[model samples]
Target: MATSRGEFSSSFGFIMAAAGSAIGLGNIWGFPTQTAQNGGAAFVLVYLVLAFVIGYPLLMAEFIIGRHSRSNPVGAYRAISGGKPFVPVGYFGIIVAGLILSFYSILAGWMVAYAVEPFFKLIGADDMAAWTVNQGNLSRNILFTSIFYLLTIGIIIGGVKSGIEKWSSRLMPTLIFMMILLTIYVLTLSGASDGLKVYLLPDFNKITDAQLILSALGQSFFSLSLGVGTMLVYGSYIANKENLVKLGVFVTLADIAIAFLAGLLIIPAMYVAANTGTEIFDEGGNLISGPTLVFQILPELFNSMGAIGVPAALVFFILMSIAALTSSISMLEVPVSYAVDTRNLQRKASTWVIGGFFWAISIILVIYFDKLFGLVVSFTTQYSQPLLGLVICIFIGWVMNRNSVLEELKKGNPEVANSLFMKVWPFFVRIVSPLLIVIVFLQSLNVF
Candidate 1:
């Protein structure tokens, strides 16, 4: 058997590292978009409940399995199941992490490119559309994507404590501080109240829609980084003295809070743009989504701030780059940890070997984004993630020994092991969480 892997030096480091994994573009971009579409505060309310109901228990399940096995995702499952047929679930998770990192690195590259735009004098262009198009040039995308992957690889080579935990400890707090400052500034703009009302006020009529609930469920699940083996890998790094239940709650809350703060910034900025006669919505009057909202809409909004827009835009993109780095390090670490633990590779060697492979894959994604990006994204998010999440829940709930899981829980918190949480969580994972994940899967497939 492999020797025990390194553990996080402190609980604070563990929580920040885990929260860094959870609070990525999914929180910064995906969450706000989902909220805007699914009735804002109504969607937010549903998402919070689901974050606890589905996200927290499943997070704890991953923690239990990881700490119990003291291994990466694949070894964790194998150890937990006594090398049963369920080992393939762990392999599936590793694959999911690889696929996600491939595309995610490319997107992070765009944030990097954007962050440097002001310094390049590109932010002052007369035609924002032309600037946007030029920024999407294939050569530029490849260059920045390569740089982003290099950064990710460099950090992984430094090992967990020196690389992931150290950077996450620094970046997460800076991301929050920048967000708070930006939120205050954006709120002072004219027409900001309109966006605030839309974001913070519940529209009961829209809350009744089936699609809205499914959207919130999916966002909550994805936002927590549950299905990608990220939490599983991070959980392995956590020390036994940490309370898994409490840590999960705090991480979930931090993730939600950052996402909510993003809404406060983005939504109000959009309304401010609209007040200045920029078209902040599409022809259908829906808030623009995806890349348009991030690259085009937000830039246009910032430009409307006159000279102040330059610094604001720089700060925003830097914030995005920091968020991307935090998450990418975690994704890269999953496979790196596996190679080191299972394959007996040195950390530097494993980081370079795996990093080179994905760096090439990320180039393909960048160069052929128009042809492959949407298809890959849909397949991963809609099919792979939900399936993987369901499998994990099943493995922990039904396949792993109940006594073993309770033992892991007791290591973290003896009180929790004997509480209603222990009684309810297993059943919830086995029955309720899986059922809800299936619903999300079906909804993704439009089978509903």
Candidate 2:
């Protein structure tokens, strides 16, 4: 088994793991709900801009930190900063990633329950609205959650080149292929154009609002798996010769494209079927949160597709579950590998110890602290994530010597003719990205 510093077999494996880390429920559930809340096309346009502008630069920063340090989050910080105050930033990433997994696994458990429900006829009730009610027992929720963690631990204990790289390579492609097929089916529906119009049209006014900007930044940060040392940890596994810029761009584009296409499948189907509009788009509303979406509104949309809805819904959820698991493995791996690296723990022991601790913590979330789950989710998306990202930006932009990082990025593409490195990149990394993140972070706290 590869330890904390295990290397990926190829550039493709690295891309797959990084992309898999990014593509999760955020792409499927979170993106659609966010789009609805802010108005469809307008939010999409702004989100794309943030993805390229703010998001891409930070991604590169993370790559630089990871590759240069060649260590996990904790070690990386100490090595780069030479015992600077930013050490906690890396620790924060580890804690937040684990905290997130604690609650995130519950959502994953819900997917597992929903994915199998159709087969068991548990979700075959006559009324879709009524069917959305809680059929999930707290005990069952915890049980399946434990199962999810076990699977994650099993894969992670197998080592990186074998575990992280191999599994994601298989699973990520399957998820993408299923998404394409689902989009094709969605296009053939009677009112699919309505969804497409809402998703693709450029409505600058709605998206430019400050709150939407905050939300977009949060989504971008989470979608790239950047803020929480996930990208940094993944980056630690790559060889020094790898092209950080090209890899960063590839993963960013893959994430955003998947998110956009997921909107195409979900929004158009909902609008064409349920005539969903602005009211349903409000933040924190039932229409946009938790299983209310995957279980409730989506079932209504699929039902409009006739007999095929059952199978389509199953396939959709199956793909989503895979995506969720793919991301979850990366999240779990961060801490598990940390223990292995720093504490001299065996891989299997570390996986269970970390997985079990988070697993138990997650059960508390689903059973007794359901409301707190929302609060934690809000904190990560709105505050902790961006804060983590801002620190990462500062680390890359100012702390790590520029000559060292640029040299790493320049390995594959020697021809830097007419690039923005001298002008846009440095400013963006130093001023623009950090400032945008700060503004969005304060807005999320309502401090401004």
Prediction-by-prediction clash tally = 0, 2
Cα RMSDs of all predictions? Answer: 2.2, 3.5
Q: RMSD of candidate 1 to the true fold?
A: 2.2
lDDT of each: 0.83, 0.77
- Candidate 1 segments whose C-alpha is farther than 4 A from its true place: 1-4, 122-133
What is candidate 2's TM-score against the reference? 0.89
Q: Put down candidate 2 lDDT per residue, 24-93, tens digits, no spaces.
A: 8877878876776676777877788988888888888887777777766887788774436787777888
* Per-residue lDDT of candidate 1, residues 162-230 (tens digit): 888888898999999999999999999999999898888888788778989988888878888888788
lDDT for model 2, on a 0 to 1 scale?
Answer: 0.77
TM-score per candidate, chains pooled: 0.95, 0.89
Under the 3 Å rule for N, CA and C atoms, how many clashes does model 1 have? 0
